[model samples]
Target: MAVQSWTDMLKASKKTALIHDGKRKIHYLFKDGKEMAEEYDLETDELIVRKWRQKSTLGGQGQWQVEVGEQLASPVASSGSDVIKENCSNPVLTRKDTKTSFQWRIRNLPYPKDVFGVLVEASERCIVIKTSNKKYYKKFSIPDLDRSQLPLDCSAVSFTHANNTLIVSYKKPKEILTLEQELLQELKKLKGTAEGDIDCKTQ
Candidate 1:
């Protein structure tokens, strides 16, 4: 005869169906829908087994009965209305409105008693200025600017030295293209010239 342990009997009692002979009750333990063991339960008949039932509340909440030995366990208490304070919530990122302004100025140079020997190279796209000392010459280029950005009238742009500073003055124009747009247009022209040169070499 095979002997079953107390732990085995208790585990089997969880899903066991009770078979009553009117004299003694038999609880059959099943694993995977196959009977594994049988245990005699004298108190299973005396103890109350609550049938599982579903209940609903006025708040539209549903509660289910737990299958305990004696009585049904109480439903968990609901936490009253969710109150979320804005300050306590996660921070939201916001993009601030910003204005970007650009200005260009030429500062004075050192050493020269006066601004002389200055050579100006002007083109439709830009102006190149070269100044020379006894030993070396320094070259600077000022790009063509939009007419709208000028100081108005803008008959002529002038560069001079005054108060130990190089000053540039121009008449502002009413409308002008952005510096970036002009640069891109220049780059496209350069690219086209480069491609033409390559095609000539390949030919």
Candidate 2:
């Protein structure tokens, strides 16, 4: 992406959920070094990106009001035969879960004219993204782990649009068991069996 200091606050909470205990979350967009927070509600599929305008009054502190902006949609979707062709950069992978079994999918990416690169960052809960160039940017939320059938975790996330196909893989866990731990288990098993079989000839 052609953004200057538009780093994503992946693990950080950019905007508070405005729904008041509703199933809404925060997505972020940074333009020209300024951060804009977008609130998305999963229940209603409604999105609102807001910009705060400061209004100063005489002999008083300035008041900040929420100014609603354009509705930006997530760039991920299913690929079809009629999809248009475009060039998208390779997906940046981040591992969410440490399990052995993997879950993944191929999606059709929507590339806006200003969208230069698709930045993907995955956590244990969801995958956050931002598609942007120099002048503009858009934020997306692709939940990696969801109980509902509508959205689920993708161990291997891939996207296809015309000639470009982006695939994202999960980082494997370092190791489940150490060599020393394995050897100790084997020794314990052997000792347990050796004690029980020593008097077998007496019978």
Identify the candidate with maximal TM-score. 1
Q: Which stretches of candidate 1 lie over 4 Å from their true place?
A: 1-104, 111-124, 132-155, 177-203
For each candidate in turn, the TM-score is 0.23, 0.20
Candidates' C-alpha lDDT: 0.33, 0.34
Number of clashes in every candidate structure? 9, 5
Alpha-carbon RMSD of each model: 41.6, 22.4
> Against the correct fold, how does model 2 do in TM-score?
0.20
Displacement of residue 26 (Cα, Å) in model 2 is 37
Tens digits of lDDT, candidate 1, 51-152: 232224454424433221222324446545564334423222111111121122333444353533443344333333334555323443322232222332
Tell me the deviation in Å of residue 48 in model 2. Answer: 37
